[model samples]
Target: FTVVNRNVVFMKELVNKTINLAKLNSDKIPFNIETISLTDEIKNSVVNNQVLFEENDIVVENHVIDEIYVEADHILLQELLNNLITNAVKYSLEEGGSISIDAVQKTGSSDIIVSISDTGIGMESSQIKQAFNEFYKADDSRHNLDSSGLGLNICKRIVEKHGGKIWVESPGKNQGSTFYFTLKKVKKEPLKQKETSISSI
Candidate 1:
């Protein structure tokens, strides 16, 4: 009875917070999205045939920075990113696995994709959907965890709100998961309107 009551309260809080975010109505905008750079790549690990990387520290992959920018709520973007990373850390193994972030341009489209992947305890099918529910918890659909069960939902809203899409996929339970969000590429210049004469003079 007590646990159920607490879950109810958590759900309410999430709804309220989401509503506020709607009022503020500021989108996340990112600039300087490079592709030819890995901000956090290993330098002294490769020798003959081996790769070594460290965990716990944020790794920035170096690659050719793509020429594309997105307009969004900066703060919301951070919140969404932080939420995913936090979840990854919260459910990660004691030894830790890996948290990777990458950005690339999608072919045949003017959009950029930012992906965050983690090697942590993956969710079951039931838990997967509940992860975004206002009060959907693994056990009770609501708990006293740091999240208000609105993190992913907020992320989904933010992405779609910005004319983008967000989704999640995993191998299965205890495997791992990757969360990806996309931002439409802004054309540097738009074509100008043409004036047509009734007849060519």
Candidate 2:
């Protein structure tokens, strides 16, 4: 039986995925947060978009904010982004739909927000509210697959572990959706390990 964490049964499993991805990508990519272009990466990847989005479409845009960088686990970030993009690609239409990613610094807050917006099948308010629950799949089409229905929850745990929050938004059914999250900006300083001292009880 899998160990369950409070509020999220998939927490431990998600961490495992992140760690595994980190080990796999350590030699090829970064493990800390850095400014990146979503379009550049996805457009260059082997994964094909199930939906063909039109040129100049505002499916998703990785807007830059004066090169702002957020504190994040890079390798894990890749996995999270990979899962989200893959899901978007799978759920989107086969033509004239696009997904864009945007990163921006939150005003009056020392955090960076990343949003992935897509033009595809939108979930209702109820579905949107419960989408992040583990093993919760609203649509049978998405449920009847070789999935654990834990991607969003996994993403949520990873984000929280990295001092961030994840959430989704949708206007209503058939309306496009956006998944957004925030990451705290970590200062560039070495973390000091605590020195253990013996104490008399």
Candidate 3:
């Protein structure tokens, strides 16, 4: 049953990924942008994957400011974070490990940088460079996992569309990895449009 269920889930993810790629290629991906609370979005993503986290006994540490806000498409941003956390869980140690998510306002910049770090199988420098490439897998076959390798690539596209950047880092294999991305921050208050009243004769 577990195998069957995992396969089914993998198939669904693949289908959705194909559709997303199609939208990206045709330039028809619509984004509903608005001021959103980053903390809430991140928490929602975490909740969505609660089952997987529990199954693995992984501890997730969220270091986010509840008041931090960003101008972005809530759905897309959630997907981006979901992909990162999913990847972290996928490559994590079998004995269970810790994952930390942090969001900080970049110094001297208008971007909010978010990072997901995991104590799992890490990647080499060369693999880090091509991590965002479509269908690129870092490990040869330490663990047999069903992955299309398009997750990070799609994440890169989503971040770029938001005028942000995404990257990964690792000291070396067995040292663990951290994925980071940035998004434009928004002030606590939305920008108000100036109103002009016309006088009628």
Candidate 4:
């Protein structure tokens, strides 16, 4: 019964990914871009996946500062994070490792770079190049049956849709990997000044 339940869940996820990929290719996916707090968004994503983290005995650290804001589709951004986090968990060490998320805005740049790093089964130079390609699995033996191989591809599409770029970097096999993506930054609005009317008095 447990095996059957797992298969059913996998099938549902596979179907969802297929539909989302088709929609993305056709440019039919809707995006509602708005100013969002990067730190808060990451926190929300982590909290949403609390069960998965606990089950895998993995530790996640979110280091994104609260002051950084970005223009993005909230739902799509959450999905992107979820995909990356799940991918990290899949390749994590047998004894469990750590995943860290951080964001930085370079001086004079309008984009904020967000990185998700993991102490997992890292990839090689060749694997990094094709990691975002649809159905491109780095290592079949390392991946579970539930992986549809479309998560990173979907992530790439989502980042590009937001006028950003995404890439992965790793030292080597068994070292670790880090996924980085950029998003347009939004400045906070200045406080309005109150008017002082004393002439009437």
Cα lDDT computed for each candidate against the true fold: 0.54, 0.58, 0.82, 0.82
Kindly indicate the candidate among 3 and 4 with the higher lDDT. 4
For model 3, residues 1-201, the per-residue Cα lDDT tens digits are 488997898799888987776665554445667788898898888889998788887899988856788888767788898889988888888788889999988899988889999999899998999999988877642233568788888898888877789999999998999999999888888644333221111
Candidate 3 TM-score over all chains jointly: 0.88
- lDDT, residue 42, model 3: 89
What is the TM-score (0 to 1) of candidate 2? 0.62
Sort order, lDDT high to low = 4, 3, 2, 1
TM-scores of all predicted structures: 0.59, 0.62, 0.88, 0.88
Candidate topping lDDT: 4
lDDT string, candidate 4, 60-133, tens digits: 99997568778777777888989998899888877788899999886798989999999988999999999999
